[model samples]
Target chain A: MANLPIKTVGVIGTGVIGASWTALFLAKGLQVIVADPAPGAQDKLRSYLEKEWPMMSKVGLGPGASLGNYKFVADINDHLGQVDLVQENGPERLEFKRGLFANLDAKTRDHVILASSSSGLPSSEFVTDCKKNPARVLIGHPFNPPHLVPLVEVVPHPGTGSEYVTAAMEFYRKLGKDPVLVKQEVPGFIANRLQAAVCSEAYSLISRGIISAQDLDKTMTSGVGLRWAFTGPIMTNVLGGGGNFRHMVEHLGPASKVWTEDMRKHEFDASNPQSLNELSNGVEEWVSNIDLESLEKKRDNSMLGLIQEKSKDAA
Target chain B: MANLPIKTVGVIGTGVIGASWTALFLAKGLQVIVADPAPGAQDKLRSYLEKEWPMMSKVGLGPGASLGNYKFVADINDHLGQVDLVQENGPERLEFKRGLFANLDAKTRDHVILASSSSGLPSSEFVTDCKKNPARVLIGHPFNPPHLVPLVEVVPHPGTGSEYVTAAMEFYRKLGKDPVLVKQEVPGFIANRLQAAVCSEAYSLISRGIISAQDLDKTMTSGVGLRWAFTGPIMTNVLGGGGNFRHMVEHLGPASKVWTEDMRKHEFDASNPQSLNELSNGVEEWVSNIDLESLEKKRDNSMLGLIQEKSKDAA
Candidate 1:
């Protein structure tokens, strides 16, 4: 089963993530069977693909890839058996996921892999509802704008089969995605936890009036973010240590400890209304004068160019 | 003083940071007076510039920029009076900075801005030694490899004058550097604190055996790092919330709080030898089969390409 080719993909719930996944699957020349209950979701997905197709082409499309390669269904249950794998992107609520996965389990073949695009909830929370082949269910979470970005966190539950994990990893890798096998189920997984860590510190700095939102963002885009885009913090630590990880840890670890201690004193508290207001207002002031639509377009275009630039490297 | 155009720069120390600063200054078409006491320091600085000149040229050189525009002096104090702005990258020691800055304060003209590229210590920590015109002394901390990276944290001590702050900002901006004025001196300033936050979380994940060091780095370079390269976290939250930052905070903030709390439990304690070993060994295993020299070259080249791609955007 691990070596079986996944020629068709079932994408349930064609929201933002789902649509992006659909676009990627189509670009990979796979027949994507999409389902969504929301009104106009089909049109929205089509429009999104139309807007994103050129960028996808620039990134290089798969053999036989086409915009008309997918079929939309109002009920995913009707076409569940046709797909080699299932990508569930229903609402993030646990109850919704529990019901959706259970239905998916009942309809799909036992050999079919069931993956969720949940950013927060672990697959274990909902997989228990699947009466058959729960071992195949796992999390295949991608960063936002999945078609453009390459990261896919392939997280498996404790009881998830090793073979299915391999299949999921191979499937995503074959599609040109960088998939990491998460060994444990942690809240927010790896990427989001890392993102939250940065955001928490950023929010703290802004709330303390130490720096404005714009400057904080500039600090990233112009500084660490540029480095992180090419190197992870661990490898960065290794390189910073002059090609010896121990040297870096011994030299810079103490200062980092002090920074972390200072950072812990000001965690972003969602419960505090004032904290939320301050952060919201800070971002508002930063984006108030700018046209968000054009800014977003520019961001997407820049990301596309960066992806091209990065691909030139052997990594 | 704010309106004064800086034609000459005094660069103290010729280590990695100092050399990079010298390269940037020369590339900016400024006559640079560099001083370092280390043996063969002048040769090392010239070699570093020779190797990095091509990348800087690709990023675009300032008018009249030349490799021979710099003069290396054995003692910075001798030519401190010749420069309009002094960028100090001396050893990171309190006593060293105190003594160096005191000499800088006494030798340089009262109007010349004395800027230290110190990463850990604040400007105030050493400025007390500058009895004459301490207001001209401040921290102009740049991220590593300052010649390529754009961020420079322009932090001022309480006694530092606003005109110098304005001068520092204007001077760095003129050289195509993104200078963020840190309103208050905080531990790790802005960029390092944010970086430490992400590193701490990354260390925890790797130490806990939840992910490999390579995957953790891949998670960043392939995921959030891509988005961060273009948009900062605050604006990212704003866009994530559908153009309303308040909405994003209210929605994702709770989950982020949970992640932060979990992250706090596993702070990277430098005192723990076992913890340091775990992180160091993890990174070692990841890089064991890779070539460090080529990787560094690849990273620097990729960064240069990214900078060029980013410069196209209006921001």
Candidate 2:
């Protein structure tokens, strides 16, 4: 954060997440060299970044001169020597990711930290046996849009060193993200696990006819979501149960019993690939039917204005 | 809601919730006649209104110019004949709430709806008999601040007419709230029940050394909380698992089974009141060591700004 020395960042893939990663790194005033073998990847990254940069700058997340910091290459060898960090945003296949990391570790300098933008996969799963110095390799998972949400889950593999963890956290902090260290290698880490917990309940509620998806969204947006944004669930309870969060734990033995007995678990088997076909079709349906992209765009503008209002109030 | 007459609202109690009720009604430009023999209850309600109104208006929830709609009477019989609605924010004791509802329902007009804001006890436990218009009574429960968060849980008693349910829902909708009607009486209704489910996990996390309360709050504020403010859990899952929410459910079931087994429940006993005493004292200790009133003021400002931002976004 104190006059960061990062001038350029190397991106290993140019898929959706990869392009987002490229845009994010570039937005922070760092030249981003996105290396991907996919045929139209570079052009896609270019178009996406060009379309997104102005909006990002409007939110004060990027400088208007963002395009100057972007570069796309079909080869990692072309960019590795000059960059400070290499971000891997490749396919979910372990073999592909592992091979990518191995090449990245071998090609990049010892001082450069290698980070991945994977949501669920642990760093150890793919980065193992990558180099003589696994000390510099770690997972720096960003939510969908790294430049916006301001959260990065930093997980260090067993072989990864403390210096790398510290550096990665500091690196993300420089980009205005609030990164939390994963003490151990959990399946989904902290955010997604809590997310899964809530999602389990949502699916159960929908499946049980207790509430529909839209009503559930409203229950949160109106009822619970308001508090969770500024404060977490525990603090919500603290203020909600009249300044004592433990009151729920202390008294509601019976209710707790019911929750445990009926609680649903989240799994990722993906048996009904058709369900995703249905869901993706649903997203397209939702988008075409309600003009969701416009809703998102409107929401972003509103959020940007709000963030400005908040900053001014704080001042 | 349609600029219909809100001449006098019968307020059936004058404790903390009742006082808050008085302020909220007055803020909404409603005449309220409060009934309470408890010393200083009327004065306290007035004092709270005077202090809270300016700030509330600054945050955009007050009809400040119309603040003349508040009245406190010594007798419950004073304004029953004229008021359009009766809000019973009385003691949580089943007998107390039941007796008040009976009195309010019997004495009030047939058109007026009687509502309680109890978080725990079900409406049916107290409002089963004696009211000539039983259908007019239900629970219109709110969180700590009924005026701010804008979630009203409307729960109708079994004997309550279906017509009143629609009326209550319509009323809240008019007030610009996202109100959900609990089809059948449940102990905590929807919001508190969802809250209890999450609280159980947070407590269990604390007990298991998974994270501290501070860290857990951070985990929420930085991660899950951000998405939650934008999308509900179901939609978050749909986005989380790479647009494959159902896929995550199917694949991760085995991993989730352990979570169900590991659910933690805390038990409380009233005879040994040390725990409750400890809780109260701990809060006292924490507050005494800090500028809690100023802290609350600071929180109010922050919350005000955030709510303003969200409302603007919604608009």
Candidate 3:
């Protein structure tokens, strides 16, 4: 295992996720080399960074962090040797990823860690094409707008090097990111699966006319979401049982079965046209009365405040 | 349809939920007549109030709110006629709730809104025993520690009066609570059903050794939970589509189905002894190292901070 510190990061494909990653890397005092063949990608990334910098500054920038520290490279392959680590946010096509990883594997040094920000695709599927040191490549998926939200799922395939896994976890931790190592290659990893679980039930309820989209959102923000912001469901259960896990399961188990049984009957499926239309229409009506741009701003601001509050508690 | 404000509340069964309701009522400047037949229930409730009062004060108490305005009564029946509303927090047994609601129905005036704090049992299940004015009885379920959390599920049965629903919604809204009217009586209501969905997936993942309990919690607290704290799943989907709900569904539909299909296969079933044991043991191991009391205190404090911050944004 190479013990070199990651001082420079290569960001591939400057989409929303990649741009956010670049902004975060820049804020953390790391030199970022960004590359995207798409027209105006550099300008868009710069604009996004400029717009998001104030909030990042409020969260406190790292030592020597600067807006001008990053360079927009024409080709990431040419700059691969200059970066200590690479974060790929390319398109989700399996063939595209396979070819990209193969190229990345050949260009980057064996010591350099290559991480993908793919939300769904696992590294193992694409790494089959990487002939050189595929062991160092893994999924470092972040929640949307990685610059703000702290979750990064550091999922390593069965063949991934344990040292690289540790390095990835430590790398994110040093950047003020909460990185969870998903033990096995699972679809959706941890956060998205949990999110899908909740969303399915939510869609089911909405489709069945048990609740409106607006009211369902209220149910979360006002109640469970408030507690969940700091504590996850399992710990929440533990707390609900008054710090006893056994007691909680024993008390709430039967009720949970009933709810899950009802929930299992429905899911948010695109194949089911009526179900999809019902949920989409409900959300459409809800958003019709909402100024989404302003709401997004408010949500980001609130998220910043919450992250700060939580970090203070952690400290 | 009496237009009288809910000035005074009768609190029956001052256990955890009931006591929390009393604290909120007292903080909202409502006269509370609390009754519990259990030994030392009054002292427990008093201590709980004293401990939680500081947080409530931090969230900014309602007009004329005071800790001393509530009276612990030996019998809530005598005071039911004096109170404008009755918030029952009795045992979960259907027979017990039926008898309690029957007595409350007989004693309280027709205009008095009787709301049960039951988490699972729907009002319709027990309202069959209410001989008089069963229309006024409904579920006013709050998330645990109702004094801090803003969500109140104002669920009314099919037979419940429309006036009572309006009154309950207005009453909670006046107290700065976010109450969502549950249009239909469903088991576990809205929040718990959503909660159960998430927990089932969480339990399944833990049991399958896909992730540790600790990391699962981190995934939530750091990722989806943060967003959920303010915006919910459906609205999140809309935002993901860049303020277009249909776009989000269409774009992410295929992936979401894959996730939900995988998630639907496993559930946290109490009847399946191994599944139950695996989840319980995982949680047990995770909590063993955690100082739950201190964690609970930290969670509550952080929750108070987040709630205060969110309310500021809303303002």
TM-scores of all predicted structures: 0.97, 0.84, 0.97
What tens digits encode model 2's per-residue C-alpha lDDT throughout B1-315?
223455567887777677766766776666778888888877777788788888757745545435667778888785798888777877778888777777777888777888888887778888766558777788888765666666788888788788787877776665556787777675566666566566556554544444445556666766567556666665555554555555656666555544443442332222345644544443344334544456456655666666666777667
Q: Give the alpha carbon lDDT tens digit for every residue of A1-315 in model 1.
A: 645678889999888899999989999899999989898988888898998899789777999899999998887778888889999898999999999999888888888999999999999999878998899999999888888888999999998999999999999988888899899999999999998888878887887778999999999999999899998888788778788887876777789878877777776676787876787677778789988888887898888777766766545
Worst 10 residues of 1 chain B by lDDT: B306-315
| Model 1, residue A208: C-alpha shift (Å) | 1.3
Clashing pairs in 1: none
Q: How do the residues A35-112 of candidate 3 rate in per-residue lDDT, one tens digit apiece?
A: 999999989988989998897897779999999999998878788888899999999999999999999999988888
- Chain A alone, model 3, TM-score? 0.97
Q: Which ten residues in a row have the lowest lDDT in candidate 2 chain A?
A: A263-272
**C-alpha lDDT of residue A2 in model 2:** 20
lDDT of each: 0.87, 0.67, 0.88
Stretches of candidate 2 above 4 Å error?
A: A1-4, A61-65, A240-289, A307-315, B1-6, B37-39, B59-65, B235-292, B309-315
Can you list each candidate's DockQ? 0.84, 0.36, 0.83
- lDDT tens digits by residue: candidate 2, A1-315: 222366778888877778877767776777787788888877787788889888667645545336667777767786787888888888777888888888778877777888998776778888775865677888898875565666688888888888788888888877767787776676666666666566556555554445445666667766676667666776555565555545644555565555444453322222446533543343343333444456556645644554455445546
Measured with C-alpha atoms, the lDDT of residue B290 in candidate 3 is 87
Residue pairs that clash (backbone atoms under 3 angstroms), model 3: none
Q: Model 1: which docking level applies? A: high
